[model samples]
Structure formats: structure tokens, C-alpha cells
Target chain A: MTDLNRRHVLGLAAAGLASTVFSPLSAFADEKELVIGGSIPLTGVFAFAGVAIEAGISDFVKITNEAGGVAGRKLRLAYEDTAYKVDQSVAVFNKLTTQNDIHLYYGDSTGFAKTINEELNRRGSILMAGASFGSELNNPEKYPFQFMAGPDYVEMIAILLEYIAKQQKGAKIVFVNSDTEFGRDPIEASVKRAKEMGLEVVGQIVTPPTAVDVSTEILKLRRANPDFTIFHGYVLAPLPEFLSQAKQLGLKSRFMGTFWSMDNSLWANVGAPADGYMGVMPYRYYYDTAPDAPILEKIRKLRPTYQATGYMQGFLTAMLMTEAAKRTLDAGKDLTAKNLKAALNTIKDFDTGGIIGVPISIPGNSVPVGRIYSYSAADKQMKPASDWISLKK
Target chain B: MRIATAKETYIADEGLLTTRTQRAWMIVLALVLVLAPFVLNAYWLYLACLVAINVASATGLNILTGYTGLVSLGQAAFMAVGAYAVAFLDGHLGTPFLLNIFAAGLVAAAVGVLVGVPSLRVKGLYLAIATIAASFILHFVFTNWVSVTGGMSGVNVAPARLFGIELASPFALYFVIVPITALMVLAAANLFRTRIGRAFIAIRDRDISAEVLGIPLLQYKLMSFALSSFYAGVAGGMWAYFFRVVTPESFPFATSIFFLAAVIVGGLGTILGPILGAAFMTLVPELLKYVVEWLGPVFPNAGAALSPVRTIVFGALIIFFLVFEPQGLAEIVRRIRRFFHLWPFKT
Candidate 1:
């Protein structure tokens, strides 16, 4: 303390801090290139899906640029990792939107999209597309510039319940979902819809999507002993835990799930118990053909690997945004968020090849369409349990 | 260049801002805070508001961990209590914004006392584990109490109204948040001047010795918990107003760790530590993003690598700070202050 030169240390510290002062001022937009930015959950609970989603958007941009840039302006996509935290997402949101003046923004989750809703409105300059399918996001009236690529959580629930009703009337059922916004997204509405369809819901269990041991939850479900159980708000862990335990306990009920849990990878985890498990998914699995699964084909050609629903959602979000942007320029309107959103509304009979069945159009910022598929232990694949279901209402 | 002699009275010497220099610095800082909103753009304003909310919460943690030496990892859970309290009451009663903040603090303080019950017997790592259990239980409640807590879908908080204007934007929230945070920080600093504050320090230094001195360990410990939780509650309420959404994910276990890290890195047992720590932790990610952005031209897949790199850098920085500058950023400030004050003197 006595011998060291304090002035030099202070000067060094000041110099170190000086670099930081200029950092917040970084990434001023390039006037010539069109910009799109996003916050992805690169390192947190959703990292597995986040990586795939990031690839989807980036690949689309790459392939599009190869063909020729959109509207003669090369599209530049910039993104930051949120680590699946809302605060970080909001920080990234502000930094990207304000500093880069990005024309379109992508978000990682339902919570982020909902939290940043007000800021998006106030800025009124960028269009927001997210990986979430929350029903709240379906309201174009409130969030005019916000859009999702698939059916809203509510619509997916309705579609599943309608399929369940078709299978057997007066069926006894159990509702099991993760205790997350994604899990709880369709419960109340599904309950009401079930009652309307004359299906008896025997039990409803809400556990964490990541819960590894669900014996207690299984015991609760066993008390109800319903004929069927539907799951929501999960991808891998808790679903397998719940399903495998239910199998060990010799529960005769058929298991089902929504889009998130319908991954092809999930079967490997649940193993033999996955034989009769069925669920709803908006996009066809990797094996589907004819309409050119453009994104999936590209992913396979380069990496030679399997794909999942997250990739589809990410690809379609970027696709729709690009389509909307293209339509704006095609109509000779300025390439602004306002014009892009308006042009997006008029997307009619858009043949998405075979990725999501043909002749698809966004109605109310959602696709509002899905199909029911059941896992076959013998064939090791998802067989169509029900035809394509559309809930225009 | 000597400007003053030693103080004759204890009161003058013990005041929160003891010297004329500190008072002047305070004035300058306040002026900057009030003026920053008008000058900073939307992004910086948003960042500033988030930092203020975090600082408010971090100050509370500093009281418990730094000063009192109880390592409770439920800061974010307490914040959830405060946040949900404000969200529910504001929706049902339509209470004034300030009142909601107070009520939020009180509710969080109540939960804090419950969480503190286990700390009576457990200390060190056990106490931390106990608090982690408490956090999980509270998370379960926040998610399952669907009728009241809105389950996992999370209930939305209506925009706060102040003088017939909505405090919806980050810029609009600055006025409501920054002043409250400042007052809370000042109040925390002032608490150390009282008997309660000394009792906390005594208990932290040696609970047995403090009990021998008739400090009433359990009562003071619980009181510290309540006080710390109250600060967290208020900050969470401000968070709700700023973010305009309340969900379980908003205040996860990671957030509690984030606050504890801030207190540790800012300089434990110092009033200025939490402030510095919270700001540094919050801004580091942004700075990392900028670092990655600088590399954008060099790397095509840098976007995919940004998150892992940020995480690595964050972990590395924390380790570096703990190993090398264990006294924290506050100590560095102290060194600078000492150097400036004793300049050109041969003491």
C-alpha cells in the first residue's frame, strides 16, 4: 500500500474501463444490408433445442443468399445467447433492436416473447417471431407485428382433444403437463373443451418439465386410473420418467402428448413403453417427402443427421418472415416492419411443399393445423394415428 | 491542503455520508442518475433500469451474506413472493404503485422469516442447502397455485400508472425505479449506524460471542432475513413494473446465485460492493456480446459459439476475481480513494 504507485494503478483501471464505455455503442447498423436479430437459449435448460433452432434460421439465410439476396439487399442475421433467462433476453432484445436497428427479431421462449411484448410495440419498427406457440401470441390484434410459425398451444390442445373424442366417446382421461407456461398453456381451455366433447377427465397432474422421478405424480395418476393420459410442456426427461413408470405399474391407459414431446429422439429414452404412446405434431418428421423439406434436406445433405420439430419451427419462422419481406418489396412498399406485417396477413394458400402438408397460410399469426401420430415399437417410428386436423375457428 | 480537523462529535463522524467530499460525490451521482434518462437511448435506459432493480436486490443480499454472514440462496424466491404479491394485489385491488411496492416487501419478508427458520440450527453449507430446498418448495407453490399464481402460464401485470401516465417503457420506468433504489440503498447504508446493524455484524463475526453479549441470535438472524427479503421484494415489484410480466422463470434459482455472486465480487461486507457487483455482472454479458460482435467478420458460425464462450468467460472472470482480487472491486475503489486523499503526503 505504501510503496506501489497509486496513480499508475488508477490510470490502468481507467484505461480498462474506457474500452467498456465504447462497447455499448457498438454494432451501429449498416445502411445497405437488411438486418435480423435474435436471442437464443444457447447454454441453459433449452440448449438442445436452441442449437437446432439457431441452425434453422442461419441455414435459411445461407440458402437464400446463395440463390440471391432478398430484395437486392443481403440479409444479415445477428444474435446473442440468452442462456434462457428473461432478463438477459430483454437485454439482448434492447441492444440488438436499438443498436442494430434490426428489421426482424426472433426470441427463444414463451416467457421472453410475452415479457418483451410492450417494448416491441413501443418500438413499432421490427417484426418479432419466436419459438413459442403460446395462445397469447396468436392475437394479431394486440401484437400485430408478432407471429409464430405453427399452431398456438390452445389450437394444438383443441386438435388433440378432437382426435381423442373421435377415438372413443365418453372416454376417461388424465391430463399431465409440465408446470411451465408451455405446459400450462392449454390446460384450462382443454378442460372446457373436453367437457364440451363429453370426455371425462379423471386426473390432472402438473409437474416440472425436468422432473426425473415422478413416482409420486404417477401414484396420483394411478388413483384416478383413467383410460387415457395426455401430456404437454415437455421434450425429453419428465415424459420418459412418467411414461416408463406408468408402464412398470401396469397402467392400461394410452399416453399422448403435444408438439414439444413428440420428438423422434424421445422414443429412444422411453424405449419399450413408447410403443403405444401417441401425440400431435405440426410438421412431418424427417422421412416425409415430395414437397422438398428444404431446410431438413439441406441439414441432411451437409451434416447427415436426423432433424426435429424445433428445426421445423425455426426454418418456418425465418421462411415466413423472408416471404413477408419479399412480398413487401414485390408490392413496391418500403421494407419496414409495418409493410412486412401487412403483407404477411395476405399469405394465402402458401404451398409449403410437403414440410407442413400443402396449401398452408398463416391465419391469425399461427398455422392452426396439426396431425396425430402414435409411436410404433416394432417399426420404431411415428405412424399417422389421425389425418391432418385443421381448427380454423 | 488540509481542509478540516478531526470531528469532535460521534454523530457527525458516524453519519452515512461522513465527509463533505462524499456528500459532493452523492450530489454529483444523483444529478447524473436524474439526467441519464433524458440523455441515454432506449437500450441504455433499459439496461440502467435492470441494473437498478438488481442493485436493490443485491443490497439486501449484502446485508445477509456480507454483513451478517448467513448464506441463504433464496433471494430470487423472495423476489418472486414480492413480484407475485404486487401482481396479484395490483390486479385485484388496483392499489397505488408505491403501496404495492411496500406490500410486496412485507410479503417477501414474511416468506423470508419462514425460510430463515432452518437457519436457526444449520450453518454454512447446510444452511445454503436448506435455503435451496426452501426455494424449490416455493417454486412448486408458484407453479401449482394455479388459481392464484396463474400456474406456469404466469399472470401478466398491468402497466403501472403514475399521474395518469403509463410507466410501460423502460425510459418511463426509470423515474419510478431509480429513486426508490437510491432510497433503499441509502436506507441500507444508514442501518449500519444503528444497534440492529452492529448486532448483525457481531452475530456474523461470532454468533456465540454475540449471544454472550446478549444479541439474541435467532431474533437478529430472522430480522436480518426479513430486512433482506424486504429489499428483494421491493426490487421484484420494481421488476414487475419494468418488465410488465410475472412468471416463475423470471425469478429462478440461478438468479439467487447471480445476486450472491454480485455481493461476493462487489466486496462482501461493504455498502458499495453490491452496487458495483450487480452492475458488473449484468453488463458482462452485454460486453461479451460486443466482443463476439467484433469477431463476426472473422467467424461465420460465431453466433452458435457465442453463448458457450460467454459462459466460459464469465466463469473465468469470477474465478480470476476470487483468486487474485479477493477483496473485490470495492477494495480497488478504496485503494483509489486512499491514494487520492493521501496524495503528495509522506504519512
Candidate 2:
């Protein structure tokens, strides 16, 4: 406003941008707190999923504190929005991993994980998790410091293909997904597996996640006449519109999607058109109380606004990270990434109280299991259509 | 009110730092750029590095869009070319980072000429649309051209090595990035003093008049594009060194808008416009984060609302400047200087 104010703004611009690097060791000299940083896409196209994931993590932290914290130290998570951009996430990741001295971190996308992989390995002191269930970050050999909460997208696609193979012998399938690192992650394998299983891979529709018009995609599907259409790489909008449009056109393709597209809110929005929409979902739903998942009870109690599968993944991500931390400390080692990672690798058949399907394990940075679920128009829910499928030998 | 000192020679009058005050400011700015990495923490340094990179890219856009009157929406693509060039060279040849930076500019300049081909036939909004198409095509290339660009997974380069010292951290990168950016900005400012540069301004002011006066439109336009993309490429090379990774999404369409906004908000066609504009554009959202943090206690949902609110505020500020201060921050700064020079006399 004023010249002096302008000068002040310039000063702040030079000195105060991000303010991301803080020597956590210097701040928490008492060693009574364990800090974690996350770069979630809390305010972009993935805002809904981001917020839901935040709710899950927040509730998990709350429950951890209520249960007297991890290793008698308070667990805290500080995350910034990446807006699903790799650059923003990498910037945030650099800040958080470096001066923050955070024991753990969460990132936004597969791209961020890939970008930060070398840095994370070099640091090797901070464990990482986040939104992606794809990329080389899942390979512990590639990046030991990072891990996905579930099986990678390619594995999920394989599981879906396996399901389809069992359901029908010679089905024609078209893979429809958002054109992104996440969406395209499993496409190659999806096609190959379909061919390997003697299924006809008709056509692949790579549309933008925010595509409003499905007329072109519908026309393609109409031409190909696939018996099954599996969608991936989108959580919120495009699938619903496409599915509804396909139904309107009397296209008889059964729709399928991965975790992102397999959301209740997505199906709820699609309504009757999503009656038999299937998903290769990795985690149990927020309302899947038949299994009496304790994580759900904890989330329902702490964060009332939490819903959808992302929250469950978020909850699982936090719980898994903190559990490792708790185990590392209980193992009577210093609260370090090395110790926690050893604990993380040692995890096998560890119970999540069935809140997220059967007991899961992180053999090599990814939990290699997922379940297929179908949405019911009448019930307004996604019920498991197949039992748990695991990639682990 | 003021005394004008006549220059005895053309060189004295046409000098880059003609005034003692300008020389002093340059020294001070140099001191700040040099001393910044040591005093500031990594976060500030990281931001400073980003500002330097963005300022370089914005300066390139300013050359075309501001001085040449050619609106380009493909600056980010040009930058990507530069970045990937650096990444490819650094990854494969292990060439010296300095050579890589120049090669980046040269490669981007070649691509710039190709993209600027449309400028021969188009101008204004049509030109902008053509550039947008160019950018989309470039992005498509970055995505599907898996071998060179590393496909959708993106390419990673080791930390730039110079004398066995890796420019890995922001602290390490500051020394490399800042001087390069400063020199590039200097080269850009120096260009306006030359024939090609004057021709660019002529084309910008009125192309038909400039053509009648014997300036070739296509040649100068392509030169402007080449120069601008060269700057973008060098900046991109610096960015690759700073970030150490290059993805198709790294230089998204939003980035082109960011540079354009910087040139406009900094004062299009002016020397200091891109610098101030890039800094302002880069820092505003960060300042907004401070505002959101301050409001966190009162508004629980502030985190969820931060993005939209920041977007609104950013748009509002841009609109406010467009409506009220069309000449942008540079003009305001000039006015402030004039007011100070007048001191008590105006009152």
C-alpha cells in the first residue's frame, strides 16, 4: 500500500517465502515430540480426497495421542498442499525432509515421490508416504525410505484383470483412465494381462480427469463394444459423467475403476447409472462396519466429517507409520528412520482390526493386496464383490 | 526543480548504468544476491532460487510479449526444452553444468524459432492461440517421447558437478543459479540498446510503420522468440540444477500464465518489470499462506479454504492492478522515486 509497506513486502518476499526449514531438533530440545510433514493436494483438483485423507491422518494422530502417543512422544503431522503438482510437492518435500528433521513425511503424487526419490534415499533418515499407489517409489530397492500404503496401481490392475478372467472366459474389455502418471501407471500391464488371460483388449480411452463431455469417449466405446470398461487415475468427476452418458446411450459395458474412481461420493453422484460399477479398491469403506473395523470407530469418534476410501487409506498410512515408530521405540532404539524402516519391513499379518480388509504387511514398501467391490444403486454403497487378492507369494 | 547534466559523448549518455545512483543500486543488489545464501536459511534460499529461475523465464516472456508485442503462451514449453536439455546433457554426457546451461539455451532457441514460425502470419490473440497450441504440442512430446524425456515418469539428473562440488541443495545451487540469472537479465537489458532490440520495440509499437521504415518483421520476431526462449532455456537449466528432476508437468500451462502475469504486473516493456513481477507473483501465495496460518485459530476449515481464497486474492490483486495501475509495480516505483526526489516541494 505505502512505500514502506511495499518495502516490507519485498523484504518478506526475500526472507520469508516458504519458511520451510526449521531445525526440529533445535525446537523440540526436550525430545517429547515426534513430528511428521505431509505435502497433500489439499486444495486443487484432488482437494476432496486431500481433505478426506487429512481427516484420516488427523484422526489417527488424535487416537494415537489418546492412546498415550507413540513411544510416549506426541505425534504431529504438518502438511502443505501440493495441488497435485510435482514441482510444488518437491519444493515442500525438500523443506520438510531437510531442516524439519521430521521422522516421517507424506507426499502428494507419484511424480513427487519419483522426483524426491533420490533425495529421500540420500537423507535415508525420514520415512515417506502419501497419495500415490504407483511408481518406482514402491520398490524398496529403488527407494528404501519411501513406501505406499497399499499395492501399486499395476498390481491392482492385475487383480482386476484376474477378477474379470474368472467372471468371463472371452470378455472384451476397454481400459479407460485419466491421462496421468497415476492413470497410465497400470495401462501397459492391464493390456498385457488381458491378452495373457485370453481376453480381447478392445480400446483404451485416455481422457483428462476433469473431462466434462463424454461424447467422444462414448463414441469410441460404442465402436469398440467392450464388455467391460475399467477406469483409473481419477477420483472425483470424469467417471461419473462418462458412466451416466454411456448408460444414456444404452452402452452395455460394465464399468470398473481403481481406488480413485471407486469412491462412494462418485457413485452417489452417478446414482442409478452406477448400479453395478465395480472397483479394485485396496481398503475397506468408511461405513464397512460389518467387519467391525476399529479404525472406523476411531475415525467416526474423532473426525465426524471423514468419509470415503481416501480417508481409510490416510488412516492406514498414518497408523502404519506411527505403528512403526512405536515399534522402533519399543524395540529400544532411537527414533530414527532406519529403526522405523526396519520395523516397517518386519511388519507381517499385522492387524488393522479388519477395518481395511485382512491383516496387511509392507514386505517391500507396498501392501500387495486389494479387493474388488461393486456399487449398488439401491443400497448406495460399495460391497465387496470378490475376496481379498494378494500379490505376495 | 531539477538540473540536467549534458553528456559529452554518446557512450556516456547511452551507458547501461548512466547514473551514480543506478551504479550504487547495482552494487547493493549484487551484495544482496551474493550475501543472501549465507544469511538466509535453506527455505528462504530455496525460494530465492525459485525467484531467480522464474525471473529469468519471465524476462524471456517479457522480450517477446512485452517488448516485441508478441503474446506467447509457450514459454513454459520452451523452458521445458531447456530443462530437459540440461537434464539430458547432465545425465548422459556428464558435461560441465555451465556448458549444459548454454546448450540448454541454444536448444531452446532452435525450438523457439520453430514455435515462432506462426508469428510470421499471426499477431495478437491469434498469435497467443498459436503459442498455446505450440505449448500443448510440446507437452505431448514431453509425455509420449519416453526415451529422451523419460516419458511420464520424468527424468532425474545427478546434482550438477563443478570442481567436484555438487550443486545439490538450494544453498549449493545459489552460487550457480544467481549469477547466471543476473547475467541473463543483464544481457536482456543490454539487448534493448542494440539494433535488433530497437527493431523489436518498433514492431511492438506499430509493425506496419516499422516495416515501412525497413525493419524485417519475420526476422526480428523470430529473433525475439529466439532470444526469449534462450533466456527460458538457461533458466530451465538452472531450474534442473536446483530441483534435480524434470517432468512434463513441471512446466505446466499454469507456469506460462505465471510468467505473463509477472511481465504485466511488473510493467511490460520495462527492464525491471519481470524481476519485480516474478518476485511478487512467486511470493503472494506464500504471503497468503501466512495469512491462512494467522487465521487458523479462528477458522478451522482455513486449510481446506486456503487454495480458493488464495486464488481469489491473487485474481483480485491482478484485476486491481489492471484497472488502477495498468503500468504496474514499475510505474508505482517510479512515482515513489519522483515523490522522494520532490520531497517537501510537492507538499
Q: What is the TM-score of chain B alone in each candidate?
A: 0.97, 0.96
Model 2: DockQ score? 0.45
Q: Which predicted model would earn the best DockQ?
A: 1
- Can you tell me which runs of candidate 1 are displaced by over 4 Å? A1-32, A168-170, A219-227, A249-251, A266-273, A291-299, A334-339, A376-386, B1-5, B17-28, B114-126, B133-137, B144-148, B339-347
| All candidates: TM-score | 0.90, 0.94
Query: What are the clashing pairs of model 1?
Result: A291-A354
Tens-digit lDDT track of model 1 for B131-250: 999999999899878777887767889899988898888888999899999999999999999999999999999999999999998899999999999999999999988888898878
| Per-residue alpha-carbon lDDT of candidate 2 for residues A269-388, written as tens digits (9 for 90 to 100) | 668878898988888887776645766765666656539778888888988888888888888987666788889988988898666578787878888789999999999889899998
**Lowest summed-lDDT stretch of 10 residues in model 2 chain B?**
B1-10
Q: Which candidate achieves the best TM-score against the true structure?
A: 2
Candidate-wise lDDT, in order: 0.85, 0.83
